[model samples]
Target chain A: MDELTAELTDLYNEHYSQLLRMAVLLVDDRSAAEDIVQDAFVRVFDSRARLRDRDRALAFLRRSVLNKSRSLLRRRQVSRKYQHRLVQREPGPDESAHGVDRTVLAEAIARLPPRQREAIVLRYYADFSEAYTAKIMKVTPGAVKAYCSRGVTRLSSLLRERV
Target chain B: MTELDTAAPRENSDERLLREGLHTLVRDVEPSPTALSRVLAKRRGRSGSRLVLGLTGVAAAATAALLLVLVLVPDRSPRPVPVGIAPDSYVVRLADGTLASAALETGEVLREFGRVDAEVTALAKGDEHVYAAVAGEGVLRVGPDGTTRRVRGVGRRAEVSAMSAANGRLAVAGGNRVTLVSGNSTRRITLDTGLVVRDLALDRSGRLALVVRDRDGGAPTLRLVPAGRAGSDRIRLFEPACAPLRIAWSSTGLLVLRPRDCAARDAVRLTTIDPRTGGRIGGGVGIRFEGPIGGAGDVRVSTDSADRVLVSTATGKTWLVDGGGVELVAEHCVVGRNCTPVPAAM
Candidate 1:
């Protein structure tokens, strides 16, 4: 109806699935990944007025999804580290799924450090420009390059080792 | 500098692999219908998000309430029972076909994707990929994430009649031959029998079962053709009464929809015959359900490759049956009848 609503619809319709995919890869849980994407849309919708160029809304959404994903990952890592009791961890969606090429790749990416995983996921998976990846990741272009190189190398070895 | 200026920055073989793999990884996965509906309803109920954002105090209070609910309350919802479905189960169907994987308990579509150019006739679910056969085109290897790679070297005129996937590979019976497609390599096995191949089924060991019509105007025959060979060691199983009883290899064994009586259109029994030895197994499954399982348009049998045997009628009725008889999974769609069943794993 309104410009904001129209823009939200377009972005959600076009990019929400992709953004959801990005989050799913970052975090292996489907429910949590959807929540992360939902959080991203809420963030974007709340700050829509500040967005001077609506064309860049997708980029903003991507950035927000990455940010939200990173936060969730951080919380997961902390919870894993500080658990007082030896609780059995529940298997996530990706872990439960057997077979399929993407399932293997997702599991491997999940094992990488957050920055390296993000670098590979953005530069290669998302096909983002290095500069744009650097902006979303909040790192220097050189750092992005290093992360991508290391991530790719690690991924190659990780997948190869599995075989 | 040129790399920086260009659209692709540091594109390489590894990047290509990453891109391809990642694209396939998330292709068919969609956000949960529950989460999506929640967001949609919120937007519709409140005209503007601006109104909510402007009221920071209200937002804070709402956030506090949400936090309180999370802390003070414990989730009591019953965990959904496992419905013998693979975690990454997916299917490929025609655009008009209902192609959404749904929650077992709720029957709400969990994930759905794929809008192909050609009509999807056959779908094969492999361990690592889902292969779809489009008529007059070629077989497409689909990743769980929805990325599709049209198989090459199989030729375009292979109008797929039946398909099966197992052990990280797929086999499509198009026309009078069956082609085994894995990665980049394809091997074709022509029947040379002068009979049209009707249906196909493959077991975990790659044993193929075919239903073919006899050129001499005799009863249609079923053939057990092994992989990588054409006619060598091929065994003709028996005559299939129903044309659609071509071949469906379930976890139990190779399943055949055997009609109860030669003339009875509505009643048929499901039997597991050994693909290696054409002998019928111990006990057969016969449903006592009363409905229109007519000879109107031939019965269609689908499986989730785990623990499901869905028999559908031409008039839009579907029955979920086990080894013995019918199980009431859902008569109509959980959402509605207009909702499509996602191929095998509905």
Candidate 2:
């Protein structure tokens, strides 16, 4: 009804999925990421009338998603460690997954530096451009290139060792 | 030199094996519908709130309000010729009989950007050349005279992920590398593992781009390699959580990145940043999500001019957008749609 409410609504409409996608990549949990983005919208709505521009509001949401995602990663990592320790302590049949012809090459990829891993994921997983990627990661295009080049070289070496 | 090249061939063989091995290991790992639906549901709730705003007051007020909100609200958000201005734009349509390209000015049939082909997966346009990726093959190039060239590489197994061309040079994404082919000269930049290249873009300066996935261990990187001999440089673009999948470059060296919803298995968000610095451009670049519009499958970002892009969302919708946001070019676009002529914004 009010200009501020209408604006916040449009901002949510325009950016909800994009924000959630970012949240998913960060959190790795579909349901939680959705909640994170929803919470972001709620934040935007709560500040509706005071917002100066829509672009600013959207940026705020993206930054929020990025922050929330980091926390999610920390949580996922902690749980993963607990699960690993549990498996090691219990010695269950699940341990056989270790022998299941784990693709060494995939493991090498998974072993890349986190920066390189992210670059590879964007370039390969979702398919994006360096400039665009730089935007998402908040870096320069050249830096993005360096990460990929070095990352690929490392991967190549790892793959070679497998052979 | 000679020794490296000799060893390079052996390494190439290994690389090929690795590629095959990687594909085999990960090909089946597509996003699940359940994941996609969950995200889509969230988007609907968010987007629906705004779409519903068309409800109350005067049409003009609501429309203006919507436009402002859409433009300024951020995220997820082209064209042409004449000495410096394009008088007629291209739009493909399945009119009466076959596919046709209708001129915006004359409303007459110009040649179709050609052949129906097997479901074109990607498309790009440069100064005088147009490129499209046929579902199964590499990129197909169409010159100004309508001549076609199907670019080929050493391996037939690599799929063309995305493409960009300008200044007589064309760059294509094959597997994890971005290959630049000019005449017969070919140079390839292979991407790092765990990184999936979603798109390729080239700035006017002949800079090459590889847009990769975003992961959390560290910041996701956007690799900008110069087209010249100096080669690659790694720049941290955004934090790993960004998860950019689709990318485009404007002539001005502005880069457009779109976040993808792996859950919905769709191109969900788009962002524009400085290609060189990776900072948010002062003026906003448009990133429009077209999926919820009409079963829009995959969103493709192609250069409309050096400055703007034409986003064809899976819904058969195309928007002529600038850095600001999605400017409604045409709504309800059908599949196999030809490039439509967009009028200069008033």
Candidate 3:
């Protein structure tokens, strides 16, 4: 194994699961999240020369996953607008009755405006600090706080009746 | 409050529930075991596929050359009647980022203008100079001898979306703002806050035709405004079903290139509209493409003094439209990739 490949393998083994879970929380689609995470790894490998440091590589992977998820959502919105139909995946047989509340909460999170959802995911799911989340989102920390507050308020109201 | 409050308040019940909910939402999610192997496999496959594509591209180029000769040589069809400012050549930014002026019919590069460090977002040509909008770097005016200089007064970091130049005048649209430049006097016109300019055109008489869409996304609308005027003087030209890809002012009227259906982009056509009343002039000519063209910067349309229209896609495919007929004239790829060519003014 070459030096770059060895470095990539180590990064992949350490951070791939966490990034994949983060993407799943952001996009709410398992297959799409997998694709996003895999593509982010491939892109990081392609640009590995610039990201020789482990910390920078991990940061790049997180940013790439977030950006790709945003692009997928934007494309999905455009497709939905033109198709004039909402697409929902049918629940599998293994989903228990307790999964219903989780589904409701997931739907509410998905309904939050894109930035707010991103903020909520980064803050609550990834558990990044406000400054770090703001750095990744390329916004001010105050903006991150605002988005999370607004998102939580909306999500709370949305779940009051169902969850 | 400071930027970072490390000792934040403890989570309330709602916050705890939200956090728990977010965690449980993806509790069953896990990365595929073969994920890293898949990425490596794709990386390896890309390099191998490039070699195969390179060979196929050579064969395709030879076949296309033969077809071009066969189509242009023995045809008995009537020659197109050239109207308006019949320009003989056009300018193209190659994949290597260099600008070159090329012959319209032969696809011959006449002169090589130097490359710009920044990407060229838009291109236009007036009688005396060729104007290129370099992203984040305002616009540059290239003289006849290929000398280039940045035009002053336009914002240094202007993200120019579309540009048109004619009769010693230039109209540049960035965001919802349009800047009209004539001589040394420059006037900036601001449209509604939420409007995003997609494309704009300039007539010989200095009138401006703009295509703009809502920032929130919808079918783009055409608008006509006089030069050096504000949005209040704008007249809304109808909303198009399929988004208008490109618009050009011709001697006959305003020409718009649009896909036949909103959902299907492969079937594109050019329609002539009355500049005054915004009505279609006849059924319009269908532009056949070998493949579906990409969006926005992928397709470009320009017209000459003789009303001859040139359509070029980023794929390096050039089509000539004249007298209600479309002909594929050239297909020249740059660096094994697609290239977009913008026709210059005569």
Candidate 4:
């Protein structure tokens, strides 16, 4: 098989499900998130001419997915505002959590500042090495280390305090 | 408290709690697997069919052209107005997005009617005039017979993006502000919006509404404020589970909302909301559609007094649905602005 196809196949096999989950966390909309990941994949597939380095394909996909998530969020904001004007409405009820523990995690993650939440997701949930996380986030490895350190520290302390 | 390095907390501890919560949410939130496979299958089938149809059509057309050449016909000068075709006003959109009109009766006669310096992002028709907004340059007003003038020094260049004309006034929203431009005066309304203004609409009564999104990229807030009045009581209408595909407002108690999943081709869905309550007005509260736009062009949506929606796409096709089921209706090319007359004939 050609290098791009092989690389795409490998990356898809390894990260497809995880990426969908991550998108859900970021957008708070599960269907939108899944769609975002699929779009990221299509974008990567379409970039056959530019992605010559097979090793960097995974990193490219991760970055593209994050960007797509941002765009989706932008559009979601617009839709919500439009809906509010028409209905004179209120924020909908919080989606019920699956389990008690899961609810706690979801609340904590949701409360996190955008950057810190992103750091936590990339470092822990995605299980990327610090170097890989740095590349995906477009930050220095030291910065990635610091984000992970601070994120984990805060997460642990918050959970501990809750207990 | 000396921090104990006991990593595994109780089953109800935060780590386990968070993991469980995330897992459940993920499981509950996945897109339909069938939706994905269905999109792929449809795309492949359509492409294959198109290839075969295209080749056969090309060969048949070529043969027809050859026969026509063999049987030469008399060449007559084209007539100005073709018989039975109604004479209509035409706007030749310039590269800079200006609206210039010409007499359609004069054999497709093209003319530069007006000069709008900026991109004409949106166009709306009024009772006696046509309005075009040049995003920043302000609105251009034109008469039915090609007389044009600018509503000069009314709206700020930096704030205006799109405009909708209602009640003989043009409502524009941009830069955390909304303005009503009339004649030679501007009435400005400042909003405490936490999000950037993306688009705006106006109802028949001139009440204004728009969609704005926060910088953090959450679901956008739709705000409704009194037309030309700022700092009014703004409320949150609905939080779309996905970004909107299209949004339009109608005069008679109808709000059209099309919440589209941005990723897959099957993600385009339509929702119609009650303009006053922001609730799904008809059949069911949770409005959803199964069809996707999938690179469709010339998408046009219109609503009626009964809140029935007609979605027209580029292929000269129309669909009839009661704000939910998009049932196909008719097929025709988008003729131009004058194609549909305002105030449906009784």
In the order shown, the candidates' DockQ scores are: 0.11, 0.04, 0.21, 0.10
lDDT of 2 by residue, A38-140 (tens): 6676666445443557756765776577656545544543344312211123333322222222245445655564455455544444344666555555545
**Model 3 lDDT tens row, B15-54:** 7788877776677777777888997787667657767987
What's each prediction's TM-score? 0.45, 0.42, 0.48, 0.38
**Model 1 DockQ, alpha carbons vs. true complex:** 0.11
Which sections of candidate 3 miss by over 4 Å?
A1-163, B1-86, B232-241, B333-346
Regions of model 4 farther than 4 Å from truth = A1-163, B1-118, B153-156, B232-246, B260-267, B283-346
Task: List ranges where model 1 is wrong by over 4 Å.
Answer: A1-163, B1-98, B104-106, B232-244, B287-298, B302-307, B313-316, B330-334, B337-346
Best by TM-score: 3
User: Top model by DockQ, which number?
Assistant: 3
lDDT of 4 by residue, B1-346 (tens): 1111233433335444445555655565544666445334444465577779989999999999999888988568786432111113223344444344333222122344455555554455454556665566576776645566776644536555445665567766566776777666778776655666655666666677666666566655566766546655444445445544334564333344444544544434555465557665333222223455443223434343223444444333444443222333332312242222111100
Best model number under lDDT? 3
First chain TM-score for all predictions? 0.82, 0.56, 0.86, 0.71
lDDT of each: 0.61, 0.52, 0.73, 0.52
Sort every candidate by TM-score, greatest first. 3, 1, 2, 4
Instruction: Supply the TM-score for candidate 4.
Output: 0.38
